[model samples]
Target: MRSRSLVVPAVLAGLLAGSVADPASAHEQVSTPSAAVVGAAPASRVTAGWTLVARYGFDGGRPTPIADESGKGHTLRLVTRNGGTVSAVRHGIGHALRFPGKCLTGRRCPHAALQSPSAPNLNPGTRPISYGAKVLLSPSQTSKGQNVVQKGYSATSSQYKLQVDGAAGRASCVLVGARPGIKLITSTVSVADGTWHTVECRRTARALTVLVDGAVRGNRAIQPGLSVANDRPLSIGGKGAYSDNDQFQGTLDDVWVRVG
Candidate 1:
């Protein structure tokens, strides 16, 4: 993977401040949206619902994939370029939704960052590895239940990694256990056709169902009894380990999140 360029001193300072300042705020005296703002323009000029939390089109040279929205919801959408990847991150300062990936190797890459107080920043890290197409979510630290849905085309790769702060394993997906033991969940799907596909994971009342493009892919009943924390922010194309330099190597679009 490549290292991203040094974030602009001002932008980095602003990002580190936990509040994103509008470019025109300091000198031009322009008003910026607060975390309460929601349902504004999308990054790709695509139309979305009024409750849109976050959206991305990957139309710029930067790595951050968050859309400039009104800041209503806590969800985020990441769009990948020809061979780019997107990631949703939650840092300690606030909620920074970003997509930092490797393209040419050893070069500094750009990533997305969104700061919001409404969401908890859990499991902070560098990046994770994703094969084919995937979506990641860091559940609310206050809630024991969680869900994630991914829809896109699948590709072939030697590495397909998904890491959760709550679990550790080699399974396609694993739920960490802050209490007792970690449970591993794996699903089989033919997602390497380079065509759009979808994968979903829903957790409620001790049951988990994995879906592919709206179709059921696998179902698992477990008593891992692992509780997902809302304080942890979700990472998509990257992991929270801050180590494994693996990043998603593909294109992604259209991401959605629903909370109970």
Candidate 2:
């Protein structure tokens, strides 16, 4: 069993491995978590057989310790840069984190993301995996590709990403196997129309399927199926502070990931 993390607070000092601490923009101080407590995250009223890895409702307006509702101890850490601010607001069941989508200087939209302190056992190999989130995009998104949630962007890196195709295209879930075997499952309709939509992606042995708004929009077959790579930390909101990466310009809530 994984050593459960405690819900204390957010600390930005040594969050990233090798990132320099900038003094240019006075970013928001990370929330202070209580401490590293034992045991899994608080058990939910209902538990599923699929085994919930981590669920971030963002109910608390504060950042750190997004509170692993799954009682799995996989607490999420906040990573904000360049005047990025994350405020907790009401959305789905309780609250959601609102990503300003614009830079504090009102110039370049930096980025805000949530990362698990340690990589959970999300590498389901050939086993069944499911991820779902409720999203609401801002009226106008400046970037073309804004990532919503991603594990590993590349194939050799061994990961998967759930991101929007372009600024205005449908959301796509991608799973990369070894070279020559990749699955880019996308939604039929666009979900970036400034509305709340539930998007889910399921990865099975033979195929990768995406269901947007409870309808099957994309179902793609996996070539050389069952390849799990990378123990990289899972990221939400954007891949990294990059232009090509899709930095989700909206509010995200009810992010749930399960593996069997």
Candidate 3:
């Protein structure tokens, strides 16, 4: 599958990680899990299975996905970014899926909870994160939040993901403060809708790989150094900052974090 070009005007802004001291930071302070708890699995254990990390049902005015009417499937994927195009498929017609977007108040909505004391801040000057998809209808209401889960951070490391959103566009996922120190791996081709899209990020001592749906989409290498809290709460549906109101406006289901 090849990617299509979708004109997505950058709108929303990016969130900046902050420096704080608290319990959340304690857990996420170091590159690896602590040794205090013996026989305990490392932080990498979180992503062991297709864990249900965050889910949205699009109910309660929250930016979550509601259960499908037919209770069958609810997801879409894009396989390529060649022409900057993406596609979203609806399973069991009549059901709606929520995509993340800026709020009507010119602000990002609220979705996840932050555990860090000095969580990052969302800047309004940044571009809006774009997703490629055909809006079926103007949802009577939409969500204004996102779910964020952070694993232990290391100066040399990578991450993995199993994500499915409405469509595949130029800017589906946004990485803030991601420089030569930090790398993000994601899928290039969208997955078949109404099913699960498994993606992974492997940050070896050298480069990074973004697996789309199942195949690799992007690959690059760079020197790395990232400052992240070890005990920070792996937030879901929202950023770590309790102050910022930027939330993911979509539905998330089955999230898992583990060591590569």
Best by lDDT: 2
Per-residue lDDT of candidate 1, residues 1-260 (tens digit): 11222121213332333322222111111121221111222112112222333333223324442433324434433322222333323332223223443334332443333232224222111111111224323222111111122211112111112322221111133433353433334444443344444443444345444445554444455443344433323434432112222333333434333322
Model 3 agreement with the true structure over 45-141: per-residue lDDT tens digits: 2223322322222222222222221222222111111111111223232223333433454323332332222112211112111111222222322
Tell me the whole-model lDDT of each prediction, alpha carbons only. 0.31, 0.61, 0.29
lDDT of 2 by residue, 197-222 (tens): 88877776676777777666666667
Q: Whole-model lDDT for model 2 versus the true structure? A: 0.61
Runs of candidate 3 with Cα error greater than 4 angstroms are: 1-102, 107-110, 114-148, 151-180, 184-196, 223-229, 241-246
TM-scores for every predicted model: 0.43, 0.76, 0.37
Which prediction has more favorable lDDT, 1 or 3? 1
Looking at candidate 1, the ten consecutive residues that score lowest on lDDT are 151-160
Overlapping backbone residue pairs in candidate 3 total 76
How far off is residue 75 in model 1, in Å?
A: 7.6
RMSD of 2: 11.5
User: What is the descending TM-score order?
Assistant: 2, 1, 3
